[model samples]
Target: MASLIEDYALLSDLRTGALVSESGSVDWLCFPRFDSDAAFTALLGDSEHGRWLLAPEGAVDDCEPQHPARRSERRRAARAAGEEDPLQGEAEPDPAAEGRPVVVQRTYVDSTFVLRTLWKTPDGQALVTDFMPVGDRRASIVRRVEGLAGSVRMHQEISFRFGDGAVVPWVRRHEDQKSGDTSIVAVAGPDAVVLHGDRLPQGHDHRHIGDFIVSAGEAVDFELCWFPSHRHVPARIDAGASLQETVSYWKNWSKDIPQQESYHAVVKRSLLVLRALTHEATGGIVAAPTTSLPEDFCGERNWDYRFCWLRDAALTLEAMMTHGYEKEALNWRDWLLRAVAGDPDDLQIMYGVGGERRLPERNLDHLPGYEGSLPVRAGNGAVDQYQGDVVGEVLVALEKLRNMGGVEDHFSWPLQKKLLGYVEEHIDDKDHGIWEMRGDQKHFTHSRVMMWAAFDRGVRAVREHQLDGDAARWEELRDRLREEIMEHGYSEKEGTFTQTYDDAEVDASLLVIAQVGFIEYDDPKMLGTVARLERDLMDDAGLLLRYRTSSGKDGLSGAEHPFLACSFWLVEQYARSGRIDDARKLMDQLVGYSNGLGLLAEEYDTVDGRMAGNFPQAFSHLTLIRAADAINGHGQRAI
Candidate 1:
């Protein structure tokens, strides 16, 4: 079985990512690109579906000790003596760790994406360093295991499940013509992977399996490269050099993250996570790297997030720009121009990496969903939905980039004008809203607010930047939208803005009333909305759910966990509202929810005390940076 959602740490090369668990198994990975079909799909299914496990030769629990329970015992014993628990004041233990597992320690090497996992057993100790080297033309993963102490026995298994575990590849051994090294290859119709390693595993039961022992000072390297089946396998890359280069690349990139002294460490890490999600070449940032990691486990709410949402990518760019990363913003802006280049009506909420538009949603019935979340989905159906807020998000992000000294060219400015035109065309159209509600479309208040922001930004562009556009018309639309929202979107009885026009229910998205400059953070209406959200959206643990799932506004079965991004938004709201104590306390708790390696999933299952939804979510991390910036008073007035 796959590890718990929280147990997996992410490794990305800007093109694609791999999820490595505490047990030393790469349970999830997509080849070539972030949206590609998975070759290691075990995270949503059983090991038989697919996984690459490299660990000490024993049952996973042999070296694991239940430390949380033990810590509870320690506290109890300390209380018996009328003393405080000694470890209470220390930094929290690694979440992935349980005292000492066979894989005792897992951590990123400084700010880099390269993950170093330490394994110690009765026999000896070993270390595995896993990384997907950056700047490669094709996707590649290099894992190196080195003996740290005395000799240690290690097991290796690789099973290729193409087409989301529905298609198994034909495996064969071949000799590299140039290097003369024996390599194992797996090929399906269009996808192929060549496995090159110093200690190659032999074939067994359709899988390449092996057992090897390494003594102190010895090391072994394994590299997996994905390519088209008909083409020749890519040449081998120098594993040692690639490791050093990857490390250097991240360290250099991290050096200029624009210091945030308060949450400096977390801000830097969140920036790194954002960078990991961004496609290095195309600049399309995926929402997350995995699909069908359920919001409600064992339910039908699961959906694919591997594609790039304009909303997510734009917001991510805004966060990056907040910390002085204009280059990334420029790259994504270029990607946006290429992606939504045609008629404004042709725009989509999301797109595949490289700006491919067709992302047909489908179910992978062969592989059970994460924790049995049924109908494992691939591709996002929301891509076709009309989200009025999307163009606004794009404009806001670009405006921030402009404020950060980015100069907009003819292409970008013209594109913004066209998007505004599109917004005008769809002014009265009911949208799926920011959450992409699958129910009947409504004039979502959040969507209306964003429409206001879109026109507002367009007006600012022409007035402030001397850009070419109809400033008077944009101002007219902006004022008209503000009036409409104040008139209909707000509820006099509820004393706050409703989810949609004439609706009574409140949404956590209401917390962003101030975030997008619709109102002051401390506006009486916003404060009232915050109070209503506190009453209805807050779980006992104080985290915020997106909306009341019980209300069936989303038209989906099964309830979801509290969205981490929503709570982070609350933190921002509190900080701006002068509730410093509340903001700080909530931020601390939310950051604590990140797993051992400081990676957060989409949501937190308070009842289960585990992560729910996709892993290392870009939305969650981007919001973390935004909230931290807000607390530090460094964020732009308009988020």
Candidate 2:
């Protein structure tokens, strides 16, 4: 059986990532690139379909101590009778540690990206697995294991089924003297995996089995590197040296993150997770590492989020830039320009990592979805939806770049002009909103407000930034948009803004009216909207839902849980409005939603008290950063 959604930790080479469970099973991984076909689909299907698990050879046991703190009881008896639990008396062991099972604690070797996981048996036997790259060479995944203490029996399960469990690889073993290491190579189509290390296990019916005993101080190592099947076998790699270098690289990268006042550790971890989701070479940030993890497990609401959405990328860049991560910000800016290069009319809402546009949605009927959700999807259907807010978000990002003193290249102005033109052409159209609802098109207020932002920023670029553009036309359009929204989107009876022009239902997205500078947070209208949201969208735990489902605006059968981003937006709204106390309280509770290791999923089931939807959502982390920035201010905030 698979672990809970929160049990997995993330590991990445910056180009792609894998989700490793507490018991040492890599259930989700996309090979070659972030948007590539799955090489391990077990997270969305059965383990036999695809997975690589390395752990102690035994059934998992849940051994919760009956008496958690006997010593604390004795100490409390010696002290006052009403004393609190000293452990709880302090902080709650960081909510990130809650529900995390005890395992050989694993992490990247200090400063390097190389991941090391250690496991020990109850009988004093130990196993160590180390994985790192060959120093920015070709696509490679290295694994090394050593036995220490008594004889440790280790289980190694490897499956290379590509295309969401459709293609299987042929396995073979070979010898290589150049690197003084034996190799086990698996070949299928254009993909090949080469394994190298000490005492390579012999193949038995397409499975490798081994057992080794080492003294207390002895060590053993193994490595695996993948390459194109047609390419010649690459030269031998130095696993130890590579591991050390990789650790150093990650430590240095992490050092660039800024320090902040409150929730520093959670913020840093969120930033680390955001960095892990980004493709290092291209700067394209994937929405999540896994696909088809249902919002409501066993339901039909599952959608793919592996591709990069322009809205998410722009907001992620804003969050990174706000926290003093200039290099990543600049890289993302370049990526944005390159991705939307060709023609304004051809601009897509989302794209592949390298900016490839054709992401056709398909179902993987062969493998059952996470928790039995059907028709596991790849690629996103929303790519074809007409989301007017995307261009607005891009314009906001470009303005932010200029505000931060990012040098404008020759292509920047032209790209902005093209995007502005697209927005202008479609500003009057009624299409899907930011939530990408599958219902009928309605005039979403947030989309119009962002359209106004587009025109407003474009006009500012010309008048304030001295850029060449039609300032008068942009100003006229900006005022026209604002007037239209004020007249039709606001509800006089409820004293709040509506989700769409034709409806009176409040949306949590209305909280962004202040953050986008659409209006002051303390403005009477904005405060009323916030209060209305609290009344209509608040879940039982005080988190804001994306919208009121009872209104039946979104055409879906089941209800969705509270969106983490929406709650963070509420936190930002509170902070901006000078309600610092409310903001701090909300921020603390929002940070508590993160699982052990400070990871967040797309949504939270307030009723069930668990994470829902895809794990480690980029939007959630990005919004967490934004909310933190709003609370702590620009420079003083932690990354």
Candidate 3:
């Protein structure tokens, strides 16, 4: 089984990424691009499907166990083992045997994304490090191995099962004339993979096997590149130079991030992970790199999030822009325009990385879901839902772009007008709201607030940026929205705004009403909503749940964990409202939820003390950046 979601770290080429466990197993990865078929699906299935592991070879023997249930047995075992190190063991075992130790430990080089894994053997140590060039457009993964101690034998395995490990490609080998080295190539359908390294393994059928001994100080490098299967052949490049370039690129990109005095290291690392999740060429940032990671064990609420949602991408861009990454913000704005172009009626709440539509949701019954969560789904069904807040998010991003002095092109102002016109026409229609609830639609208070924001920002664009738009009409609609929301959405008896006009339930998303400038942070109503959220929605650890699942509005069984982004929004609200001490307390607790690598997931189950949803979520990281910036006096900048 794979480790917990929080026990994994992220590595990417800025187009796609892989989730590597702390135990040095790359359990999930999409090749070539973010939306491409995954080559390693072990994160959602068994390891036999696909995975790349380089870790210490050991059996769980003796230790000062952390879990209370195992402590007594662990103590007894520790006394029996005396002083022996638990990790020392043999490398090879029966392939069909159970309880075998494979990959073991992983970490990144300080201030860089280069990941190193250590595998132990009875003889010595084997090390593998993986990294990618930060700003490069090409999709590349580089792996290097070294021997640190006594002579240790290592095994190399390669599998080319693509499309969630269902498509096995034809494999071939070619010898390089200049270097006298061989490289393996796998071609199937639209994808082709080329592997280059020293001492290339000999192949029989679709399998390859090799054994090499590495003494102290010995090093070897391996490089893999994916391309279109129709491409003639891949050219050779210097692996050493590629490694150096990748390191230099990441270091330079890391330097561009603004430094913070408090939680400096943690904040910088989260920022880098966020940058890695962004699509370099298209500027569409994925919500998370992998999908179908369940939010609750044995629950069927799993949905794919690899595609780009307008709201998530916009907020991600805002976070990056606020941290001095203006280029990413501009690129995302351009990508947004291209994605939402054409008939206003056809505008989707989410899109593929290249703005491709037709994202029909489907299930892969062949592969079991993470932790046995059934109905492993792909391609979000929420694409067709009417999310009223999407246009508001886009308008907010456009406003931020203009505020940052980004030049509005010929298509930008007209596109903004068209979107605003659509919002003007459909602002009253109650659809799915921001949560994409499959249940009945109601007048969600947060969605209404965002509608007001859309019109408000639209009017400001016309007035300040000198853009052409119906300024007077937008202003009137904005005021009307405010009036309607106050009339129906507010619950006087509860002293707070309700989730929707029909229900008096408090939602964590209500915290954003103040954060997004829909209302003053210190306003009595906003303060009341904040207090209600803290009392009703927050778990014991101070993390905020998405909503009261007991209300049965989400159309799913079994409650989900607290959403980290919502918690961060609360932190921002508290800080902006002059509750600095409360804000700092919550901030510390939220930041402490990060894994040892300083990466966060989509949600954290406070009661169970486990991470839920997808790993290295962009929303969580963006909110962390936003909250940190607010507490640091940077304030929320328009992006």
Candidate 4:
């Protein structure tokens, strides 16, 4: 079985990423592009589905103590004292951990995705450093094993399965003429990878396995590169130099962020995650690197998030802009111009990394999902959904870019006008809400508010930026929308805004009303909405759910855990509305939900106390940045 979602940390080369577990297994990886078919799909299935693992032969969880006499005694003492068990709510200890090499420690080399893990066996100790070279050199991963204390027995396994683990790749072993080092190549159709290492594994039934011993002062290097099956093998890279370059690249990129007073380390780490999720060649920001990680485990709530959602990309841009990352913001702006260029009417909610449309969602039935959550899927069906709030998110993010002194050219202004024109044409249409609900389309209140925000931005551009547009017409539409929302979207009986015009139920998206400048964060009506949200959305663990899945509004079976991004939205609301204490308290609790590496998933499963849904979620991290900014009073003003 795969490790818990929180146990995985991301390693990115800016083009694509790999998920390395605490056990030193690269279980999920998509090469060449963010939207490409995964080369390692063990995250959704088993090692047979494809994985690369390098660890001691008998590796075990470090937390499971080898000498259990003192551990049992301490546990008994704590239980007798009536103190809560430290392992309460945790999964039962895996019996399989016995007799395995113990991991002493694992952490990213500070400020970089370069991973370092220390392992200890009865005989010796060893250290492993894993990282992806920062530059996009056809996607590569370099892992180095160095003996630290004594001679340690190490095992390595590589199972190359392409086409999302459906293909059994052909492997060939050859000796390098120049250096006489062993090299292995795995080929499947057009995808091929060359593996270079001092201690290469032997191929067996489409799997590569090896066992070796490393003594103190000895080191070994393994580098894997993915390329075209028809092309010549890529040249070798010096692992040490590449590592230094990768470290320097990340440090230099992050050095310029404005000095943060609060959540300083976490803010920087979240920003790096955003940077990691973005495609280097194109400015498209992916929602997450992995697909088919369940939201409602063992259920059908799993959906692919590898594609770039307009709202997510826009929010990511805003987060970057807040910290003065204009170059990246402008790149996303250009990508938007290219993506939605042809027709204002043909805009999509999401797109492929290269701005390619026509994402067809399909399930890979061959592979069982994460923890047996079946129907592991690829692509996103929501791409075709008409999410009315998307352009508002874009407009809001772009406006932030403008406020940050981003020069708007003719193309940029004209494109905004076209988007506004499209909104004007479809202002009265009923469609999917921000959640991309699969149920019947309704006049979602959040969507309507975003419509109002769209016009408000147009008026702002014309008035504030001295840009060319119909300010008078936009102001009229903006006022009319505000009136419409108050009259129809809110329920006087419920004392709060409804999820849709037809229902009295509140939605978490309502929290963004003040964020888009539609209402004051502390207005009694808005506060009433917040109160309703607190009562309805707060789960057992004090985290916020997106909505009551029992309501059948989303047209999905099975319930989901609390949404991480929604909790952050509430934190932003708290910080902005003069509820600083509430904001700080909630913010600290929400941050606690993140893994040791400061990475968050799409949702938090309170029952299991584990992160659920897609790992390293862009929405979760971006909102974290926004919430932190609001807490520090660095959020200039909600766009």
lDDT of each: 0.87, 0.76, 0.78, 0.88
Off by over 4 Å in 4: 60-99, 634-636
Q: Once all C-alphas are superposed, what RMSD does model 4 give against the true structure?
A: 4.6
The TM-score leader among the candidates is: 4
Instruction: Report how far off residue 359 is in candidate 4 (Å).
Output: 0.8
* TM of each candidate vs. truth: 0.93, 0.89, 0.90, 0.94
The list of candidate 2 runs beyond 4 A from truth reads: 59-118, 125-135, 146-151, 199-207, 634-639
Tens digits of per-residue lDDT for model 2, 56-174: 56523222221222332334354456665444444323212443223566664543445556665654555455454523855666666665666565656666566777777888777
Instruction: Tell me the deviation in Å of residue 151 in model 2.
Output: 4.4
Separately for all candidates shown, the number of backbone clashes (residues 3 or more apart, or on different chains) is 0, 12, 3, 3
Superposition error at 282 for model 1 (Å): 0.9
**Candidate 3, residue 264: CA error in Å?**
2.5
Comparing 1 with 2 on TM-score, the higher-scoring candidate is 1
**Lowest lDDT 10-mer window, candidate 3?**
60-69
Pairs with backbone N, CA or C atoms under 3 Å apart (clashes), candidate 4: 58-100, 58-101, 59-101
lDDT by residue (tens digit), candidate 3, 518-636:
88888999999998988999887778888988999988788788889998998888878888788888999999899878898889867456788887888898899878877886344
